[model samples]
Target chain A: MFKNVAVVGATGAVGQIVRRLLEERNFPAEKFRFLASARSAGTKLTFKGEEHTIEELTKDCFAGSDLVIASTPDDIAQEYLPSAVEAGCKVIDESGYWRMKEGVALVIPEVNPQDALDAKGIIASPNCSTTQMVLALKPLHDAAKVKRVIVSTYQATSGAGVQGTADLFDGSKAFLSGEKYEYKAFTHPIAFNCIPQIGGEKADGYTSEELKMLYETRKILGDDSILVNPTAVRVPVANCHSESITVETERPISPQEARELFEAFPGIQVIDDLPNSAYPLPSTCDGSDLVYIGRIRKDISNPNGLSFWCVSDNLRKGAATNAVQIGELLAKNL
Target chain B: MFKNVAVVGATGAVGQIVRRLLEERNFPAEKFRFLASARSAGTKLTFKGEEHTIEELTKDCFAGSDLVIASTPDDIAQEYLPSAVEAGCKVIDESGYWRMKEGVALVIPEVNPQDALDAKGIIASPNCSTTQMVLALKPLHDAAKVKRVIVSTYQATSGAGVQGTADLFDGSKAFLSGEKYEYKAFTHPIAFNCIPQIGGEKADGYTSEELKMLYETRKILGDDSILVNPTAVRVPVANCHSESITVETERPISPQEARELFEAFPGIQVIDDLPNSAYPLPSTCDGSDLVYIGRIRKDISNPNGLSFWCVSDNLRKGAATNAVQIGELLAKNL
Candidate 1:
C-alpha cells in the first residue's frame, strides 16, 4: 500500500479535518506533509496530539509524495494540478475545478469505487453538497434508476471556507448588537438570514453550485441523460448541508423498499421515523462521517416521484472524509 | 382608510411589524388596539415612540373595529375569528388557518387585489414564503401564463414564530461556544446547518410548509392545474425568505421580456445585473416591504423554463405588510 501522503491547503477548516481524519483512520502514512499558501506556511497544526508544521505549497510541492489530497480553492487547484501530475504522485482534488474535466475521474468511493481505479494520477471530489446528496441518491438510483431529480440545498457557511463561517458569526453579532454591518465573505449578512444564491450566477440563471450538481452527477453516475434541477442556497449553519430531494424513478418503488436500500448502504444512516420526532438532524451528525437521511416517502403529486430529506456534515462527507476515502481506495488499487 | 384597527397577537413578531407598518404607512389609524395572549396581556409595546398597552385578546377585542388583523397561531385564530367577524369588523388573517377554507379569499394585493372585494368579512393572507414568491411570479405569470411552477424556499426562522428565531440564536451560540446540543424550536440544530424538511412531513412526503406553498399559490393565482412542486426549508436567517423559482410558461418568453414584466410590477424590483453584484439581498431588504428579485434567465435545457431568484422580508411582504395591505383593501371595499 502507498504510504507517503501530502495534504495541500492543510491550514483551512477542510484541510484540518483532512489531516485529523487521516490520523483517526490510522492510514499507513510513511511521510506526512502539510502544505498551504505562503501566509499559512510555518504554522503548526496538531493532529492526534502531535504538532506538525505546515510548509508553503508550490508547483513542486507534490515531489517525494506518493499521494496528495488538495482541499484548496478552485483557482489554486486549476493552477497546481498539472504540477502534481507531472511529479508522478496520485492527486485527489476537493474543488469543483477538475470535477468536470475529461479523463479526471470524479470518485465518491461509497457509490463508485471502481471509477477510482481508472484515475490517471488525478481524481476529483465533487461539490460538498453534491457529495452527500449523491451518496444518499445512489442506493435509490441503483434500486429504481432515478430519471428526474429536483433538489434544493440548504448549505452551511463552512462550505465557503473559514472566512464564510467567521463572517456568519461576526455579522450575526453585529445584527444582535444593533451595529453597522460590513460585508466580507458573503454578499449579504448571513447571520439569521438566507442567501438564495450560493455560487456566482451564470448566464442561465443558475448559480455555479446548481450547475455543478447537474454536471457532476452526470459525470459521476456515468449518465448524462439524468435530468437534474437544483437550487442552491447558503444558510447560517456552520457544518451540515441538507437537501430536499424530489426524485422520479424509471420504476415505481415504494417508500419501504427505498428505506431498505438506504439502510443497506455502508455510509448511509436512515433516521426517517417521523411520528416519534425521529429524523436525521444537523447536530446529530455534526462530527460523524455518515450521511443522515430521513423523511422518505412517495411524492403523491407525480406518478413515480419520491421525496426524501438528507443531511450530512459538509466538511466531512462533502469534503475531507470523501478525500481521505479516495486516498484509501487509491492505496488498495495502486 | 383603515382608521380603527385591532391587531390580535400584537406582541408577536408579525403582529409587531403589522402595527409598525401601519404607522409608517400612515394608514389613517385613528385608534389602534393591541391584543395578545393572556400570558402577555398588560405588556407595553412602543410604536413610533408611543407606548401602547396590550390587552388580553378576548372575543370582544374586535368590537367597533373597522379592520381586525389576526396574527395569532392557527388554533388561536380558529378560536377567535368568529368573534372578530361577529363584531362587524372586516378581518384579515395573517395565518394560513382560513386561507384555503371554502369561502375565505386568499389575497395578495399586487396579484389579486380584486379577491379582497369578494371577501365576506375575512381576507386571508397567503403563507409568508408563498406570498413573496407569488408576488414576484405574478407579473411573469400574467404575461406568460405559467403552466407549472417548481419552487424551493429558503425560509427564515421568524416564519415559525418569535420562539423559533430565538432558538436559532440561542442554539447557534451554544454550538459555537462548544456546548452540548438540544433542539427545541426545530428537530435539527439549525445554528450551523440546514434542515430539508420544515413544518413536519405529510403522508405524501411533502412537508406541511411545502403543501402550503403548493396549495396557497394555486388559490391566490386562481389556478389549480399549475403543478407546483415545493420543498420548503427553514434556514438560520431571522426574517427573510428566499426562493429559487422555475416557471414553465405556456409559451416561450425571453429573459429580457421576463425582466421587463418583473420590473413593471408595483412591489417587485429587478436586480439582475450579476456582474455588478446588484441582486436582491435579504440583509438589504430586512425592513423593506418590496420583494427584491434578480438572477432572471431562461433555462437552457428547457425551452419553456424561466428561472429567477427572489428575496423579501418574510415578516413584511410574507406576513405583516400583506396582512396590512389586505386591511387597506378591505377598507376601500367596505
Candidate 2:
C-alpha cells in the first residue's frame, strides 16, 4: 500500500466527489492529504469523520506523498504534476493537459487497465464526454472492429464545473421570472436552450471538446485507425451527460447481439425498453458510476451501423469515480 | 387570387402562427374564414385587424372556400382532408396523416415547389424537424448526390403543442421550488432534461418521428434511395428546434463549397463563425422563418461526408409558415 495519498484540487467539484468516493470505497491508503490552489487553501473540509484543512498546492508539495490524484484545471496539472512524478509519486491526473502528451497513458480502468499498470509518468483520465463514449465503444470494438463513429452529445451543466450548475439553476429561475441574467460560465444562456459549441474552436471547424472525443478515443482504445465525427453540444440538464451515438463496424451487430455484448461488458448497464418508455435518461442516470446504454437499434442508414443512446453522470463515471477507480487499480497492482 | 380562403385549426399553436403569417405576408385572398374543432368554434380571433369568429370545422364547411390550409392533428386531417379534396378546394395540410399518402405531395417550397404545383390532391407540408433538415440538405444534395444521412434532433417542447410548452414552464417552476409536478405532454420530465423518444414507437425500434425524417426526406426530395438514420430528442427550449446532421454524399463537398451552396439556397442562412461563437442557437433562431446553418465542417470519419448544425423555428418554418407558403404557390399558379 502507498504510504501517503494526496488529493489535489480538493475543494473543486470533481475533487469533492473524489474525496467522497475515496472515503466511501474505503480506499487503501496509509495517510491522506488534501491540497488546492492558494485561493481555496485553509478551507476546512471533512474527509473521513475528521476535519482537515486544504493545503495550498505548489511545485514542491508532492515530496512525501507516494500517490497523487489530481483534479485541477489544465495549467495547474501542467505545472504541478511533473513535480509529483519527479518526486517519485505515482501521479494520476484528471485534467486535459497531460492526456495527449507522448508517453503519458490515458487510462479507463475497464477499457485499458494495463496501460495504467505499466505507466511511468502521470496517468491521465479523459474528458468527461470521451470517457463515457470510450467505455461504451470498448466492448463493441473488441467484438467487431469499430470503423467509424458519429456522435452528438447532450452534455449537462455540471460538466462545466460547480459554477456551471449554479449558472443553470440561477439563470433558469431568472428566465422563468422574466428577468435578464448575466451568465458567467457560458457565453450564451443555457437555460431552456441549447449551445452547439462546447470548447473553443480547434482545427477543421471542430471545437476543442469535439476534437478530444476523436483523439482521446484513439489513445484509450489504442487504435489510431478508428475515425470519429463528433458534435458536442451543451444542454440544460444539471448533472449527467447524454450522447446519441451511431457506429459503423467491420460487421453488422444486430440489436440483440449488441444488447448481449453490452450486458456482458464491465462498467455498462443496458436499459433499453422502448414500448414502456424506458431508456437511459440524464435524470435517471445521475449520481451513478456506470455508463448506461439504451435505445440500442440498427442504424437504418448504413448496413453495418448500430445506433444507441448513452448516459452517465459526468462527475462520477466520467470524472471522480474514474480517477478513484484508477487509484484502486494501481493499489491492487502494488 | 382565390375568392375565398378557409384557415382550419385556427386556435391552436401552429394555427395561430399560420394566421399571423398569412396577415404578415399579405396573402392574396379575397375573403378569409377561420375554422376549429367544436370546443374552440365560438372563439373570437382577429385577422388583419378584424375580429372573426371561428366556425366549427366540418365536412360541409368547404362549400364557398376555393382554398383550404389546415394545421390539425392526424385523425382530424385523416377524416376531413378528403372532403376538401372532393369539394374541389385546393387543399394544403400541415398534418402528418396525408403527408405520405399515395396521392398527396409532401412539399417544402424551397426544396420542392414544383411538387406543390403539381399535386392533384392535398398538398402536404413536411414535419417541422424534417422541413429544416431537408432544406439544408437540398443545397448539398443538388451539388453532390446525398447517399446517406445521420441526424440527431434537439426538438423544442412547442413541437408537442401548447401543452408541451406549458409542462416545460410549469414543471421547471415546480422543480426549482422542490415540488413534485406531473408532466402532461411527455412521459418523463422535460424541465432541464431530454427525452430521446419524441413520438410513439414504430417498427424496428424507431419512433414515428424518427421514421418521418427518413420517409419524409425520401418523399420531399423525390428520391427513395437516400438512406437516413435519425434520433429525435426533446429538449427544454420553448420555441426552436435544433439538429446535428451529417451527410455522406456521392462526392466530397468541402466546407467552403457547402457554405457557398447554403448561402445561395433560398430559406437557408449560414452563421458559422466559431471564433466569435456565432453559430445558430435556439435562443437566437427562435422567431426566424429561415433555416439557420452553422458549424459546417468536414465529417472526419468519411471523405465524402459533411456535417453541420441546423436551427429553425419549429412553429414557423416547420409548420405554419411552410403551409402558408404552399398556399401562396398554388394561388400564383391559379
Candidate 3:
C-alpha cells in the first residue's frame, strides 16, 4: 500500500465522488491528502470521520505523497500531473489530457488491470461515455473479435460537470415558469432538448468527444484495427450516460449468447426484458458502479451484427468509481 | 378542387396542427368539415377564421366530403379508413394501421409524391421517426444506392400526443418541486430521462416503432431490399424528433457529396458547421415543417458509409404536414 495517497481536485464534481468512493470502499493507505486549486484551498472537508483542510495544488505538493489520483481539467492535468510523476508518485489521472499520450496508460480496471500494474507514468481513466461503452464492448470483443461499432450516446448533463446538472435543473425550472435562463455549462438550453454536439470540433467533422470513443477504445482494447462511428449527444438526464450500440464482429453473436457474455462479465449487468418494459435506463442506473446492458437484440441490418443499449452512471463508473477502482487495482498489485 | 374536405381527429395534437397547416397553406377546398371521436364531437375549433363545430367521426361521415385527411389512433383508422375509401373519397391517413396494408401507399411528399398520386385507396403518411429519416436517406439513396441504414432516434414527447407533452411539462414541474408525478403517456418517467422503448414489442425484440422505420422505409421508397436497423428512444424534448443516422450505400459518398445532396433535396436543410457549434438541435428545429440535417460526416466504420444528424418537427413534417401535402398533391392532379 502507498504511504501517502493524494486526492487532486478533491472539491470538484468527480473529485467529491472519488473522495466518497475511496472512503466508502475503505481505500488502503497509510495517509490521505486532499488537494485542490488555490480557490478551494483551506476549505474544510470530512473524510473517514475526520475533518481535514484542503491544500492548494502546486508543483511541489507531491513531495510526500506516494500515490496521486487526480480529477481535473485537461490543462490542469497537463501542467501538474507530470510534476507528480517526476516527484516519484504513482499517478492516475481522470482528465482527458494524458489518455492518448504515448506511454500514459488508459486503464479501465475491469477491462485492463494489467495495464495499470505495468504503467510507469500517470494512468488515465477513459471518458464517461467511452468508459461505459468500452466496458460493454470488452466482453463482446473477446468473444467475437468486434470489428466495427456504431454508437449514438444519450449522455447526461453531469458529464459536463456539477454546473451542468445545475443548468439542467435551473433551466428546466425557468422553462416551466416561462422565465429566461442564462445557461453557464452549455451553449444550448439543455432543459428539454438534445444537443447533438458534445465536445469541440475535431478532424472530419467529429467532435473531440466522438474521436475519443474511437481512439480510446482502440487503446484500451489494444486493438487498433477496430473501427468506431460515434455520435455523442447530451440529453437532459442528470446522471447516467446511455448508448444505443450496434456491434459488427467477425462472427454473429445471438442475443441469448450476448446476454450470457454480458452476465458473465465483471462490472456489467444485463437488464433486458422488452415485453415487460424492462431495460437499463438513466433513471434506474444512476449512482451505480456497474455498467448496465439491456435491449439486446440482433442487428437486423447485418448478418454479423448484434445490438444493445448500455447505461452507467457517468460520474461513478465513467469517472470516479473508475479512478478509484484503478487505485484499488494498484493497491492489490502493490 | 374538392367540393368538401374533411379533417379527422381535429382536436388532438396532430389534428390541431393539421388544422393550422391547412389554413396557413390555403389548401384549395370549397368547404371544410372537422371530425373527431364522440368525446370531442361537439367541440368548437376555428379554421381559416371560421368557427366550425367538430362532428362525431362515424362510418357515415364520409358522405359529402370528396377528400378526407385523418390523424387518429391506429384502431380508429383501421376501422374507419376503409369506409372512406368505399365512399369514393380520396383518403389520407396519418395512423400506423393502414401504412403497412397491402394496398396502402405510404408516402412522403418530398420523397415519394408519385406514390401518393398513384394511390387508389388510403394514402398513408409514415411514422414521425421514419418520415424524417427516410426523407434524409432519399437524397443519399438517389446519389448512391443506400444498402443499409442504422438509425437511433431522439424522439420528443409530443409524438406521444398532447398528453405526452402534458406529462413532460407537469412531471418536470413536479420533479423540480420534489413531488411525485404519475406519468400518463409513458411507461417510465420522461422528464429529464430517456426511455429506450418507444412502441410495443413486435417480432424479434424490435418495438413496433423500430419495425416501422424498417418496413415503412421500404414501402415509402419502394425498395424491399434496403436493410434498416433502428433503435427508437424517447427524450424530454417537447417538439421535433432527432436521429443519428448512418447509411452504407452501394458506392462511396463523400461528406462533401452528401452535404450537396442534402442541400438540393426538397424539405431538407443543412445546418452543419461543427467548428462553430452549429448543428441540428431539437430546441432549434422545433415548429418547422422541413427536416434539418447536420453533423454530416463520413462513417469511419465503413468504406461506403456516411453519417448525419437529422431533426424535424414530428407533428408537422412527420404527420400533419405530410398528410396535408398529400391532399394538395391529389388536388393538383385532379
Candidate 4:
C-alpha cells in the first residue's frame, strides 16, 4: 500500500487544506513530507500535532514517497510533476497545465472515480469551477443526456488564492476609507464590483477560466459531445463560488426529478426551498465541501431546459477537498 | 410647455437623481416643486442651485403641476399616480406597479419614445434591470429581429434604495470587523455575496424582477413574440447593474456588426476591446446614463446566437434618468 505521502506547495491555501484533510480524514499516510518553492523551503506546517519543515522541491524530493499531491501553479507543477512521476511516485496535480493533456485523467471523484483508477502516472482534478459543476451534472446527465449548458459564475475572491481574499478586504477598506489603492490580486478593483474576466484571453475570445470550464467539464463527465457556454465573473465574496446554470437536455427532466437526482447524489446537497428563502448563497455555503444546489425551475422558453443555482467553497470542494477525495480513491487500490 | 414640474418622492434616492438630471439636462421647467412622504415633508432639495421645500405628497399636490415625475414605492405610486393624472398632470412613474398594466405604455425613451408621446395619462418606465436590457436589445433587434434572450443580471445595492446601500456598507464593515450582522436590505448578506432573488416570488417560480425583464422587454420593444429568460442576482455594487446576455436572433449577427449597431445607436456605448481589458465594469460605468456593452462574441454552441456583457447605472439610466427622459419627451409635446 502507498503509505508514504508528500504534499508539494505545502504552505499555500489549497495545500494547507489538503494537509488538514489528510489529517482529519485519517488517510493511511504513515510518513508525510512537505515541499515548496525555495523561498518557502524552511517554513513549518503542522500535521497531526507534528511540525514538518517544507523542503525546496527538487527532483530528489519524491525519491522515498509512494504518492505525491501537488497544489502548485501551472509552471511549477509542469516543472516538478514529471520528476515525481519518474521517481515511481503516483501523482495528482491541481493545476491547469496537464488537465487537457493526453493520457492524463481529469477526475472528480464523485462523478468519475474510475478515471482515477485508470490513471497513467499523473491524475488531474478539474478546475475549481468545473469540479462543482460536473458533480451537480453527472447524475442528471445519466438520466437525461445534457445537450447544452449556459452558465454564469459568481466566483468568490479566494479562488485567486489567499491574496485574493486580502485584496477584497483591502480594496473594500480602501473604497470605504476614501483612500486610493491599486488592486493587486485581480485586473480591476474587486470590491463592490463584479469583473467579467477571470483569466487571460484564450481561444475565440473566451478567457482561460471559461475555457477550463468548457473542456474540463467534458473530460470529467466523460462526455465530449456536451456543449458548454460559460460566462465567468468574479464577485467579492471571500470563499464560495455561485453559478446560475441553465441546462438543455436531449431528454426532458422536470425540476422535481432534477432536485431528487441532486439530493440523492454524493457530495451534493439540495437547499432549494423558495418559501424559506433557502437557495444557495456564498454566505451560507462557505467553509463547506458540498455542492449546494437550489432555485431549480424549468426554463419556460425551452421545453428540455432546466435552470438552477449552485454554490460551493472554491477552496474546498472546488480544489482541495476534491484533490483529497481523489487521493482517497487512489489509496483504495494501493 | 411643462413649465410647472413636480418631482414626487424628492427626498429619496432615485428621486434625488431625478432632480439632479432634470436640472443638468436643463428641462423646460419654469417652476419646480418637490414632493415626498409626510416624514420628509419639511426637507429641502436643490434644483439648478435653487432650494425647493419638499411638500407631503397628497392627491392635491399635482393640481398646478404640468408634469409630475415620480420615483416612489409601488403602493405609493399606485395610490398617487391616478390622482396626479386626474388633476391635469402628465405623469411618468418609476414604479413596477403599473408597468405591465393593460393600457400603461412602458417606455424607455431611447427604445420607444413614441410610446411616451402617445401616453394616455401616466406613462410607465420598465424596471431598472429591464430598462438597460431593452436599450441594448432594441438596436440589435431592429437589425436582426431577436427571437429569444437568456440573461443573468448583477444588480447593484442602490436598486433597493438608500437603506440597501446602508446595509451593504454596514454589513461589509461588520463582516470585516469580525462582527455578525443580519442582512435587512436583502434576504441574504449582500456585503460580499450575491443574492439570486431580487423581488418577491411571482409567476412560474420567477421573481417579480425576473418577470419584469420577461414582459417588460417584449412590451418596450413592441414585440410580444420575443421571449426572455432572466435570472436576477443582486451584487455588492453600489450603482451599476451588470448583465451576462446571450441572444438568439432570427438571423445570425456577427460580433462586428453588433458592435457597429450599438456604436451607431444613441444612449448606448460599446466598450469592447478584449486586448485592452476595456470591457464595461461597474466601477467605470457608474453615474453615467448610457448603457455600456462589451465582451461581445459569437456563441459557438448555437448557430444563430451572440453573447455579450452589459452594464448601466441602475439609478441614472435604469430608473431616474429614464423617467427624466420621458419627462423631457413630454415637454416637447406640451
Per-prediction DockQ comes to 0.46, 0.89, 0.91, 0.75
Given candidate 4, what's the lDDT at residue B326? 90
Q: Candidate 2 chain B: minimum summed lDDT over ten consecutive residues — where? A: B110-119
Interface RMSD of 3: 0.6
TM-score, candidate number 4:
0.99
Worst 10 residues of 4 chain A by lDDT: A272-281
Estimate, for each residue in A146-243, the C-alpha lDDT of model 3 and write its tens digit.
99999999999999998999999999999889999999999899999899989899889899999999999999999999999999999999999999
What is the fnat of candidate 4?
Answer: 0.53
Kindly report, for each predicted structure in the order presented, the TM-score of its chain A compared with the true chain A: 0.97, 0.99, 0.99, 0.98
* Cα lDDT for residue B183, candidate 3: 98
Error of 4 at B131 (Å): 0.5
Model 2 docking category: high
Second chain alone, TM-score for each candidate: 0.96, 0.99, 0.99, 0.98
Clash pairs, candidate 3, are none
Candidate 1 docks with a DockQ of: 0.46
Give the top-scoring candidate (DockQ).
3
The better candidate by DockQ, 3 or 4, is 3
Number of the predicted model whose lDDT against the real structure is largest? 2
User: Of models 2 and 4, which has the larger DockQ?
Assistant: 2
What does candidate 4's lDDT look like per residue over A1-334, in tens digits? Answer: 4668989988899999998888888987789999999999997878899988889999778899989999999999988899999999889999889999999999998888898998877999889999888898888899999999999999999999989999999999988889987878888899998899988889777889998988999888878999888999998888899999989998989988998899899999999877677799898998888999988999877889988999999989998899888888888877
Best-first order by DockQ: 3, 2, 4, 1
Number of colliding residue pairs in each model: 6, 0, 0, 0
Q: Candidate 4, after superposition: displacement of residue B152 in Å?
A: 0.7
